[model samples]
Every structure is written in structure tokens, then in C-alpha cells.
Target: MNFAFTEEQQMFRDMFADFVAKEVEPLAEHISEHEEIPKALLKKAAMQGFLGALLPEEYGGAALDMVSYILLLEEVAKSDMSTAMVLHVHNDLVSRAILLCGSAEQKEQWLPAMAEGSVIGAWAFAEPDPAGLTNLQVMARAADDGYVLHGTKTWVSNAGIAGLMVVFAQAPEGPTALLVPADAAGLKLGQRDKTLGMRGVQIHPVYFNDVAVPADAVLGRPGDAQAVMAAVGDFSRLAMAAIALGGAEHALSLGVDFAKERKQFGVEIARKGAIQAYIADSAVEVETLRSQVYRCASLADQGLLDGLSASIAKLWANRVSYQVANRMIQTHGGYGYILDYAIGRVFRDCRTVEGIEGSNRTQQAAIARSVLAAHGFVM
Candidate 1:
């Protein structure tokens, strides 16, 4: 199987890279310090067709394949993780979920506007509960005309700014998902969180108090929340792996540039045996992680939900990113600790990968279970 990108894909990557370098990189320091991604930037991305890279053309998207989508994400992440966070949550997770699972009417109603960036989508998951444990304790309830949603979803990316939300809730039938308008009655956005990294994305808690959604707002079949969640988890794992790979590449590049320039003991640091060893090890790990991520992406594009592959990719990429960023920091010496340099911010962003989407321990368990199942073990 050929792993090379087509000319169109290469062009897409180059164009997007240039866009990020001009539009995103210049604002990275401001976003990291201020903790807010400018709304105008998101609008600009939308106008550039960056927000709908995965949706079908009928829905106003670029109709790009999974490889192109992942490539766009990696490019954006390489420059500013916060902007990538917004795009990932909005386009990859929420928009893709709607496209895959929404009814024909639902798609017609939501996708076009969302594709144009007139409507922003946010995924509501990740409660305070520990990883891999399903807690059917949502306060949302369905009644006569519609479902009454009441709960607090924390660590929600694009919470306050998004125009729509795909909310997962527990009901008597089973866990259900609902598409809620951001302006829906009784929905309230809490204060923005000050996270360790990925700033400017506006993570926050959304409180729903007796918020009513139309009966048609439910996504997919009833009692299929677990399945929807599993699908989302799979997509998230692959996307996060892509992001981690990009961040690792960024850190490795910075380290190489820094080592070649900095003088130590009357010579360039790049000439030092120890620094060369660090660069070699980081390059090897980054390439390995990139291959694994691409494998998972290819499998997913083929509609193969290979849970073990996804989990392994996510686990390895996350760990590799952390190691690479830390080493980059070490190579930069005192300069790495300063906020003006991108290495420190990249380091913090890399650390967040191990915990989000699903923790490393959870991914390990999933992989183990898949292995046992493949070997004919049950339960």
C-alpha cells in the first residue's frame, strides 16, 4: 500500500502551513498569555474552509478524506495548539458525529450552517468521573414534548462560544445524546477554566437547568449512547494522536535549531555528543509515533474500528510527545522555562495528552482487552 500523499494533499498541507505561520504563529504568544482565541480567527478559518474539512461537499465542506483532515489538524497544531483544540472539538468530534449518526433531516438542518461556520459545534463529555467508568447519573430527563436537560459538563472545549452542543445524558431508556442550541432556554455557561495548556480554547462548565430540547433533537437511536460514545472515543483517540505527533515534531525541530545555535564549552551544543544523542533519540521516536498514527488513521478511514490499534497509537503518541518536549526543554536550558519561547508551552500541552480523551491507563486496559478477545478469550 502506498503511504505517500497525493499532489493535492501536499498542496493542501503547504497552503495550510503557510496560513498558520502567518495567521496563527504570530498570535501564539498572545493567546497563551491571554487565555483566549480570538473569535475573528475562528471566523477566518471558517471562511477559508478549514472548519469543514471532513464533511461532504453537499454540506459545504471541502470533502477531504481522513488523511487530509488529519494533516490539516497536525499543521494547525504545530503552530498553535489552542486553535487546533477549537478545530478538533468543533470539526472532528462534533461535526463528524452529526454527519455519521444524524438522521437525514438532522443532517439537512445542522450540517450546512455548521459547515459554513455560522454555527459552531461542541462535544459535551468528560465528567469528573474516573476514566473508562460509565456513570449514568446525569440530571437530564425526557418528558412530554421534549427532553429536559439538567447537568453540568465540565472541561467542555468551546463551551461558552459555540453555537450548538452535542450533549450526552443518561435517561431511563439508556444514555442518550441530544443536539442543543447554545441559546436554548435554561442553559448557562460557567466561567472559563484556566488550564495548564491549550489556552484560548475556552474550556468551561455548561449548566442546564430544565433546558428543553425538541424530541427531534435526539441523535441516533435511543439507548445507543454507549455506541455513539465508543465511536467518538475512537475518533478522539486518533485525532489526539495526530496532535501529539505534530507537537512532538515541533519540539524536535526547536531542539535541533537551538542546539545548532547555542555555544557551550567553546563549541556549538549540536557538536556535543550528549546533545546529538538526544536529538537522534527524539527523531527516532517522533518518526515511529507518526507511522503509528498514520496506520490508525488509515484503518479508521477504511471503517475498521480496530480498538487495539487506536488505543496503542494514542498511548504511544502521548508518551512520546511528553518525552520529546521534556528533552527539548532540557536542551534549551534556562531559555526553555521562559514563556516567550514556544518550548515551554509545547511542554505543557504535551503533558495534557496523557490525561484527556481517555487516560493512559484506560487506553492500556482497552488494548489488553482487545488482545484477549482476539485470542478467543471472553469477558
Candidate 2:
């Protein structure tokens, strides 16, 4: 039941915070306005060893533990949410998947370049008709030379920038994941698809029109896409919550500051009982969410994570992060609604959190199944 961060972990957190303060925070507005993350900033993060946060040291990575990775992501999100998300997709999703399931040859070929920021990574799981693999619109058919993947992937993060991608499609075997080079023939990177928020993040649609790849491109086992994707989902669920909590904490800070600074009726709004209550409630909620996320992350580090724990954390984040953002806006009144303030960006972004990864409704089903299984009940 030990709960304190180690000295090394604290140092890592402070280093990440300092990096964000100097590099990411200043560019938050610029990124939002321009809708792009400067390549230089990503290279700076690579130099800081963040791009390789999950890989083993042998792969030229920092080999950070789950807790440290979570901490780094939260701090990044605190300064810039889109930057945190791109890191999550690259480090937590793509790289972690390769580390966990990729062949030694695959690891040797990709990890070093990814760590060096010479290559960027993206995950293409969602589709125009995303039914997981059970009802995949994209299908991969085996040829004598290899496999040809045909279908469109929607809402793919880092699509335009990534030199490599991990793609999932239905195969002669069940669902299958394959490594597709960004420049592969028949692989078309569509224009950036705009969304509700996270403007700096480049999410796009990709049409895989008979893209062929060698047999060695298959990830994990040929028919093991379900399990591979499930594993990634657990990591993604926890990571999404950490990102959301960062937004919530930032929102609380904005609210408390505005409450203290904005005067009303000859006194500070901080003097108002309502303002005091919002601040108090937000602080408590944020701290509790933080603890839950860390606890889940700890379980993951210890190999104890399951869908249930991850879902609980995501549900907490999805429900409460939005509430906290709304409170921040209410505290700001007309100013919060204005897009000029960074808090407004947090508010817009937090709303979309409910729908990304797995939605709240989907998570509920997972949590329910796990809970029932804990008892003698079977579905």
C-alpha cells in the first residue's frame, strides 16, 4: 500500500512539467490556431526521450515505467492536450503493442527509428463503420506473396505525419492487425478531418485500396486481432482517463484563479459561497480521479489490470472531467465561452472525450460483464 512517487519518478515529473512549461504551454495557442504541432517540438520531445517512453533501453528509449509514463502524459496534457494524445498513440498504443507482441526483427527494425523521431506512428482502429473486427468493413485477403488490405479507416490519429501505422482488418482468419508503411502503394492519406476539438492533433481518414504487404507484416497471430486489440484497449482506456484528469486539474486551477481575481459587488468572486463550493468540489474530484488513475496504472505496472478497472477509471474521467470543465466555464462566465482563453479549448475538448476510444455506453457494458463475472453470474 505504499503510495508515494519515488525520487526518480518525482524528478521525471518535474522534468516533464518544466519541458511543458517551456515548450508546450507557450505553443498551445499557436498550435490551436494553426492546427498543427510543429515538427521541431516533436523533435525536442524526442531529444528529451519522451518519444521512446515505452521502449526498452536497448531500442534507444528511456524505458519508463507505467507510472512515469502516466505522469508524463498528464503533465503534457496539462499544458497541451493534443500533444499528450499524439504521445499516447505513438508510445502507449503503437510502440507498446510492438513491444508486447512484435517479433524481435520487427522491434529491431522499428523501435530505434521511432525513438529517434525519424519515424512517427499512428493507430488506425476506427472506421466509418467501426464494429470492432466483428463487423469490419475493411478486409484483408491473403495472396501468395502476402496480404492485400482493402477498406477505409476513419478518425486515424497522426495519419498524415506517421511514417508507419498499425492497422486492423478482417482476414480469412478473424480480425488481424498488420504493419503498413505510410508510403505503401494503394495507401492514400486523406486530408485532415476536422473534429470537435484537439485542433493541433492531425486525425485523418485513410483508404487502403488493396494495399499489399508481406506475410511478415502480420501482427501477433493472424487471427489474434481480438486479443491484441483488447490488450491495447486496456492501455488506451487508462491513458485516456489520465489525459482527461489533466484537463480537469487545469480547469480547476483556472476556476480558482478567476474566482480570486474577478471582483463582483465590491468584493472578489472568491468571497462568494458558490465560487468557494465549485473550487472545493473540483479540487476534491480532481484529486480523487488522480488517485484512481494512478491506482489503475499501478495495477497495470504490476500486471493486474483488467477491463473492469480500466473501464471504472474511464467512466470516472468521462463523467467528472466534463463537469469540471463546465465549472471552469461557469466561473469564467462570458469570457470562458470565448475561444481566446485556453480554458475554452479544454472545455470543447473535454466534451468529445465522452465519445472517443470506447464510449461511456460501451464501457458500461464491459464493466457490467466484469462485475458479473466476479460473482457467479455468467452472461
Each prediction's RMSD over C-alphas, in Å, is: 1.5, 1.1
The ten-residue window of minimal lDDT in model 1 covers 130-139
- CA-RMSD of model 1: 1.5
Badly placed stretches (over 4 Å) of model 2 are none
Cα lDDT of model 1 by residue, 1-379, tens digit: 8788789888988988999998888888788888998878888898888888788899999888777778888898887887887888888788888888889998899888888898888888766662322564455576897678877787888886798998888765677888999999999988888889887778888888889988788888765777667666787788888888888898999999999999988899999898898899999999999888877777777888577888898899878989999999999999999877889998988888886777788888888898898899966
Model 2 lDDT per residue over 260-367, tens place = 889988899999898888888888889889999999888888988888889999998998789999998999988898887778988877776787777789889988
Ten contiguous residues with the weakest lDDT in model 2: 129-138
Q: In model 1, where do residues sit more than 4 Å from their true spots?
A: 130-134
